[model samples]
Target: MSTRHAVRDDLDSRPWTGPTRRYDILKEGAIALAIVAVLTFGLSALFSSPDEPALTFKGWSQSAPDNMYATMVAEMSGSSETAGYGPPYNVNSDGLSIGPLALQKWFGVTHPIDAAQDFVIAPLQSQQQPDAVTAAVSQWTSASADQRTAWATAYEDALNDPAGANGDATKVPAGDYGPVPTLAAAVVAMASSGAYDGALASAGGHFFNTDNTKQTMLMGDGSYMDDLATAGNLQGNTWGMVNETGSWPGQQWLATYSFWYQLPMFNNEDPNNTVATVLTDNADAIIFAIMFVVILLFVFLPFIPGLRSIPRWIPIQRLVWRQYYREYGKR
Candidate 1:
């Protein structure tokens, strides 16, 4: 018989000579469970997890009112990031196109959002704006699109002046903003009442207001989260998403993918007009695509010609099973 066949037949005929020991599976399992439970509770109690409350518009508006108003103006002018976020949000990402790879646009506005209407006017209407605020909204709705744009632009420009310095609505100088200032001021007042947040949260399906999408989107301008994130090194530039704040080493494991977002092109709001910069603006998509390819390579490692041969060349598995090799003799 061939060596392999002889080895198999002998193994099949081999008698069991190993010693046996009594074992109580239930007892052993119970002990293991008890030990694990104790360790889990001890560790969890020792180091409490991040239990901060969810970020809310009320907190943001109260913390940074000027920033809120400026963001509102940006939304009205369609200059906010959400205004031009392209696909999935229903608007063009301003100019986030890449050599026909407008994948976001291809998906096409699954969740439509008109920033001005959704974030401001609708919320105000839901709160039942006071007569002055209501009149402003009425005038705003009745005006021609150009007139409304002109009004918002004028108001935003006025707010940009020294009086409106530091995003504070209290400082804005007099301007030809028509009813915009009235509407903006009223919205700011509504912020104090937190009606804006309530209106937005309640805007979801009548059955359940669990989805806080609109309320959350209102803070997308980034100013609200910047302070906390920067302090925690959580911003994209700090690679904060992957790293922990302070001296603690955060999830370094995520560095592999997050590395792409740290690149200047991806981090910058406008890194000039180069093609690389354009690609950077759409870094999320690019990174996802890259990760997909990497996953495909790993999944098909055995099928990939050159890559599949790496295991044979390196043979790291031998190191891992070195003791077994010594016991059985090397194949």
Candidate 2:
């Protein structure tokens, strides 16, 4: 009877004393919701929407028509990040990988497209009364590779000389230069006239709904891209391209890859740029993925074996249930 009374006295001395009305579930939920709403609105107002640059071919053409060829060449040179961007663009190029694996090429030229013709020539051909431009393009098509190279080389050289503020390219000196300049001029004129986008519309006896190909090609041109890079401070030293006219964050995720270009290893290495870019991108992707997985595991580590026992080992449990220990003694 005395032992029973002692045990009852110990239980009475303990602190918990069953469920207390300390917390109101509804009140806590309302507070959490209010905090979340305030944060969401604040972030929305502070950061705002993502920046979208007004970089249309028409705008570029109107602004700098003389640099069309330089623009075209740049468009041709850069890697088409969207070429095989998959679904909602081109079905064939979708989901195919390219690199050492060559999955894209092995898939057999799916969505077979001639970047030059599709992006440049086709748009010009669609313009009203495009006979002269059409004739020049036809001549270019019939011309030999040497002849085309000669024209391009000559025109490219001619562009080096400065012209008036109106952006008129100096005429090429008399030579065996084919109809490339004339064709290129027509494209410039179309762009200048603000009909470039309208010409891009595939409404004339052909299916040309997809504008991605043309836009991609247009963005690749070196001179145009250089202009844009300059405007946006995307050049190597300034960092990868950002939206030229806005405060939004640029490609922050590519900070590492951008940093690699700053190193001496990639600097002054033009010929190896493609290979280096591909290798660096692949390596970075793998490393990031591994690190992400490691972080996730670390976050949930408390539930893992050999880790859950840490709480007990550290005597934190003893501190938490000190009243129970005082009455019942240590386990």
Q: Highest TM-score, which number?
A: 1
TM for every model, in the order presented, reads 0.80, 0.58
Best by lDDT: 1
Where's the lowest-lDDT run of ten residues in candidate 2?
A: 73-82
Itemize residue pairs with steric clashes in candidate 1. 66-167, 163-171, 244-250
lDDT for model 2, on a 0 to 1 scale? 0.59
1-331: candidate 2 lDDT, tens digit per residue: 6998898768878886654447799999999999999998998999887665757677777666656655543222222333334333344343423334434344554454554565566776676646777788788778776666667656555544455222335554555556756766777677777787666655344574764555554555536656776776767655664323456667676665466555544444465677655544444344445456656767988768877668858987788889867977764
Each model's lDDT: 0.74, 0.59
User: Would you give me the overall lDDT of model 1?
Assistant: 0.74
Residue 110 of model 2, lDDT score: 42
Which residue pairs does candidate 2 place in steric collision?
71-221, 74-220, 74-221, 74-222, 75-220, 75-221
User: Candidate 2 deviates by what RMSD?
Assistant: 9.3
Please report how far candidate 1 places residue 19 from its true position, in Å.
16
